[model samples]
Target: MEHCELPRRPGRLDRLRQALPRLFPFLGWWPQVNRRTFKADLWAGLTGAVIVLPQGVAFAAIAGLPPEYGLYAAMVPVVVAALFGSSFHLISGPTTTASLVIFANVSQLAAPGTAEYLHLVLALTLLAGVVKLGLGLARLGGMVNFVSHSVVTGFMAGAAILIATSQLGHFFGLALPRGGSFLETWGALLGQLSAANPWVVAVGAATLACAVVIRRINPRAPALLLAMVAGSLLSLALDGPAHGIALVGALPASLPPLSLPWFDLDTLRTLVPGAVAVAMLGLAEAVSIARAVATRSGQAIDNSQEFIGQGLANIVGSFFSAYATSGSFTRTGVNYDAGGKTPLAAVFSSGFLAAILLLVAPLTAYLPIASMAGVILLVAAGLISVPAIRHIVRTDRGEAGVLAATFLATLFVELQFAIYAGVILSLLLYLRRTSHPHFITLAPDPASPHRALVNIRRSPQAECPQLKILRLDGSIFFGAVNHIAEELHRIVAQSPEQCHILILGSGINFIDAGGCHMLFHEAGAMKLSGREIFFCSLKSEVMELLRRGGCLARIGAGNVFKDKSTAISGIVARLDPERCACCHLRVFDECRARPGGEDVE
Candidate 1:
């Protein structure tokens, strides 16, 4: 007997095809890498490193984490995101929004800058990564769509205010308590204005002034770094540590050491809510930045793969003593502008950051906390995005409501609750808008070709006395069925003498079981009243739904009209001859041929 060969299995090949690109997104760019690309990426990476140094330190202060943790965040997470993410120029690291949120949530559980706080932050990062990884594996990356642009704008503006408030004590040397409410912080600052240290205030003001002047003269001149250097030198000149000016002190110079996040059940339980909020906010920030950059590069992005990359970055980062991080818009824009040609540029940035930390971490002791405050203040100002806020407020009232509500909630409520509230309000507003569609009464206009239908209110033309025509220009989903039913009932009640009705179904794009049942019941009610209902130009999908739901059978196939001409002719033929004799305006073609008839068409 001849040996039988089993059919070749494509199972492995199919899995490979789907898994390779997702697991190693960098593989797609490998063929494009060359000597020229390397040189471009090198320069871009150099620029990115310079930009992130001061920013990382300032963001670390914002998160109430050690300055070294920020540097570590820029290392592992940056490399991991670049290797696994779908974007060519997006740079991931410590960002202001994530930092602010981390401080807000974690500060409530433990004192800022304590061992307990650090452990809690680690737990939060790990939990968030797990959540993000689960969402990516489930292919639920599209959940970001529900986070409206208005919510982000409002949340950022609110968070920016909080950032400024948090740094005020450092800016003015007032020694305000950590993690105070916005109002309490302001109140405390007000009572201690007379005790402000002039030396620290001068240093902060000088740093802010330098940053502004340099940025105005040359936008690419690393203004934050220069300003911080000037402030540090001024603090040294004044011997600031003795003069009550706080300093960041020395940061570790070695590579990030491995450590596990605390896995106590109670710790995980306490952090679960915060972790969920951070994961959503971080993913939205990453995907939005990626898509925006890809629009310029004309590159396609896989949102699910981005989610996975971010998840892995945070998960890996937690073990390296890094807190929660996300995409940095500033670094990403600089990377693209500085001629980053591939994802390799981001990898090179991480390498450059690691090398820079080795050389400069000890020197951070000279960097005064006041200067960091000034730099972060600039960052906070940038986050407000006046143009975006103004545009949202000026254009749409509903969106403005969402923005205001979110902004207020962020100011008064917990950060997690603020985010959830904003999302919920946005969805409610969207549903409210769609629940009531425009109900248009249409009449035949003789001036147009084919006697096209026009709004009765606009054209003011005589309509058929024996029939009523209406156009519903929205979906017939469950949410909208009640409103549509009431409108249809009102129209019939207004014209009881008009026993037949015609619905122009061309405007309807979708219909569900609720909508089908509504139509079936309406048809039955009409038939009982010695009247009839007809649908013209029903969409194929809507007709299929009606048929499959058995509504078409109950309503009768003869009542379903595929075209206006056939529907008009059939309805006119069935009209009482007595009523036709009483009609003054004969709009139908059949009426023109009748004895003693007047024709408008």
Candidate 2:
């Protein structure tokens, strides 16, 4: 009968089938790729390729890297992210926010755009990628939730201002120093306002005005690119170069070359904190964009898989002259809107960008820096969502405080420290909320024929004279047990005549050891005072927690009811006969019965 042979070791083919999907998640959807999808992806890819030309250069300028690095990031990272990411249409590339973070953090250690600085940036990228990959592998994608949305929003607003300030020199045709504080930059700009060059200012103003009008007129147009071209033609026509207008210069006509990130202990120690901040911010940005787009695409995103894809992008792209990269809202949105049907669109985008860079590398020499500034200013202005900010400011005072703190810190302090401050404040605010749950005194609804319970304060209805009911609306844990205990004590003090207490525990989400212990001890104390504590309508998980904590048994399992009907009948049966005889507050349907089995007229 025991003829079952031990399972044979899986063959190589079997193992490959098991592991390949995890390694390359595209396998899940690659089978669906067809001729119709290919044509759609090709069109989407072409459109994205055109748009990234201006964005890549602008993003690179923000990061203090050569424009080529931005295009390079657009290539390898885009392909890698598309190949492995769970989102069908997420297009990863250099982003303005991540670029700002790079400049803000790394500029402190080394001068921006220096060889050593580039190395450090690469190290930061590698570290962030490694951290992300580790998190993905561990399936801790939910960790991003701890970084409050308000924190990110405030940081973006502050970073937007910083981006505009950084470009002020080119925008106004002044010789402002790079990496200056926002106040210092503004002071310098004001100081040099009288010396501003008319030609450069005109180019920037024309570019900004053109981009704005084009964007308003046709939202689908490549406004930044067209505006840059217009500004370039105007600058050349006015002989702006001879008039001291700076040009972007020619770019390298090649693909991304091999590179290495610094890994020495001193470098790691110096850059670790900033790298962690970068990783957190990038993960938040990438995952949020993926989820937002996935809603429209009707595709389920595996968040951990998205993390893995982003991690791989940065890690692999670092070896290809790319700085840190992540999902771009603009590019991803364009890809989806342009009818991208699969991840192949991203791969085609990389190929097209590589081809375009090689072909048009020389034309960039005519691209004026002031025009780029105009484009960047528009991008920075885009970051300030007045509506989102207004909503946050009005809805929740605590969240508003968190937003204010993050915004101020991002403006006044080190960028990494600002992130830390915001995250810490978010956790504190969250704890403040969770630790103070609401306790509502409940009574029978006067309007309901069945006498269902309702909030006593809002409904102003009659309650049982010998018993009181309460509804708790939060978790009960060590940090909150004291608060709950005080509320329980206060309820008793105010209504001592109601000697029996019934807690409607349906709203209780969790109960920890301390909470269970406090309930047990309170039950004993209540019995000593000629009263009883009962619990009803508790969730199963909370009930299990109480049982496991030994509090349920110590408090007497008979005092806990699985449903309201049993609790009402059982609790009403224990009320004093003398109280019932004279009681006018017969609030429960069970109150119709006398203390004995007989019904009252």
Candidate 3:
């Protein structure tokens, strides 16, 4: 009996079903499970959770919230970010900068640790989520491009300094004034130098030294955790309270509780500004880190998707008693280094954190504030990329200026305003550079036998008597129209004898209405002078612009050519033979073939 061949079934529907959850993201990584992966994910998650223990409490303190809130922020937001975000390694949680900014802005309106303050924090988180979600839905992912690399570099450098400085009170165990500017903090530290507690200072110094050494010798070492452990032991050895040292008190054992943001209009109005600041900073940090990792991994990350993920994370987290959450560069780097293969690793990290929290919540009370300060110091040090800063300074002066300005502004001025300043400066500098396109007169090279090399600004070479060749090397937009027009007029004035002009239009990438008008007027002027304007190797887009503007008709279609040789030949044929007979210069091969043409004696 012959068996009939089985028909192949298409898995189109199956593939579609698999892809559907990628947009929502909760279902994307659920299917990729095995014993090995589960174990790996569990370990990665535990590592992340352990890492956040001290960090969560410290960040919460910085944000003017109770210690538990920091843990709360880390718990729910992390899970949401991992589930929804596109990056395999990007773990979202409380960041020091975001926390500090939140405290500085929100503390002005409400008392810290009060119910009103918590409500405001929730409102800020919700608003930030809404803004981020709106941006993602609007496909404004390209907004990140508007933030210059220099601005980020500068801002991060300033933030590093600020972070380090902010921890000085705990680092030295000094009762320093809170919420002061960077300079003010430094001044306060100097003024209160005599009040520094030796025991706290010793713990912080020891922690920092240990972390530094461990990181240098073996980067894989859990330096932060180890340093915290060392500091805590040192504090206990000295009986920290006896030496006027502060400790992080008992932490709550429960998971984040479900809550809603206050719905008062006045509360919303008060929280909006801070929420905007938080959203901007959070998105910047997250998107920058994601892009950096994406570049190295050869993975395409959707910024819009990232925005949505972060927005959802924050929104979900707010209800779960979490403050604003953002991408953590440190954790992301760790995730990548740990060989995390996909977003599942991040999701697993969240799961691990939740499980670890259940077991290790009580142990966090023993972690000293000085030890956390030491970790913050280490993080601050990491933020200042000396090599990258040096490269920026050496390569581009304009960018360096912007970087310096942003750095200073972020330190002295409001953080939001500083970012705005950097963006504005970046745009201004860009406009200044592009407003004057390079308009160079081109001549055949005498040194090169092939006559291919074109000179700009400085050319000792002679020009052809009839045709003047120019290269316009930039977009001919409205901003550049005046500069180009002036340059063209100047070129014509300098070479009055050369009546015909041939523009090598290959470099003219774009032409606006103003630029087209200027070109038309120039062509008209040349024609009135009994000469013709020609374009060789003109791009089709520019040609269309000229055609639509009726420039080609006025300049004559015969004047336009596709190649240099064709243009030279055509111009030679139309040359005033009477003028050519008396002309001693022979600039073209066609001139040598003319009846009156003779080799230059």
How would you encode candidate 2's per-residue C-alpha lDDT over 299-391 as one tens digit per residue? 987889988999999899889989999888677766775678999999999998888778976776788888878877886776666777899
Instruction: Give lDDT tens digits, candidate 3, residues 1-601.
Output: 9999998776999888877886776576667766776665555565566667767877899899998899888877887887787776788999877898888788998899999889888888989998888888788888888778788788777867876897899899987887688888999999999988888889999988987888788765556667778988998899987777787765566788899887678777877888888898888878867765665578877788889999999999889999998988667655654456667767666666676567776666676788878777876776676887899899999999999998999899876566678889999999988888876777676567656536635756667787788777888889998888888888788888888888888888888788888888888887888877888888899999989988788778998999777888898888888888877767666777664786553
Which residue runs does candidate 2 get wrong by more than 4 Å? 1-22, 25-74, 86-128, 259-302, 323-353, 595-601
lDDT of each: 0.83, 0.84, 0.80
Off by over 4 Å in 1: 1-20, 28-71, 87-127, 230-245, 260-301, 327-349, 588-591, 598-601
Lowest lDDT block of 10, candidate 1: 592-601
Query: Where is model 3 poorest over a 10-residue stretch in terms of lDDT?
Result: 450-459
User: Total clashing residue pairs per candidate?
Assistant: 0, 0, 1
Pairs with backbone N, CA or C atoms under 3 Å apart (clashes), candidate 1: none
Q: What RMSD does each model have against the real structure?
A: 5.3, 5.0, 4.1
Model 3 lDDT, full chain set? 0.80
Give the TM-scores of the predictions, in the order they appear.
0.82, 0.82, 0.86
Candidate 2: global Cα-lDDT? 0.84
Residue 93 CA displacement from its true place in model 1, Å: 4.3
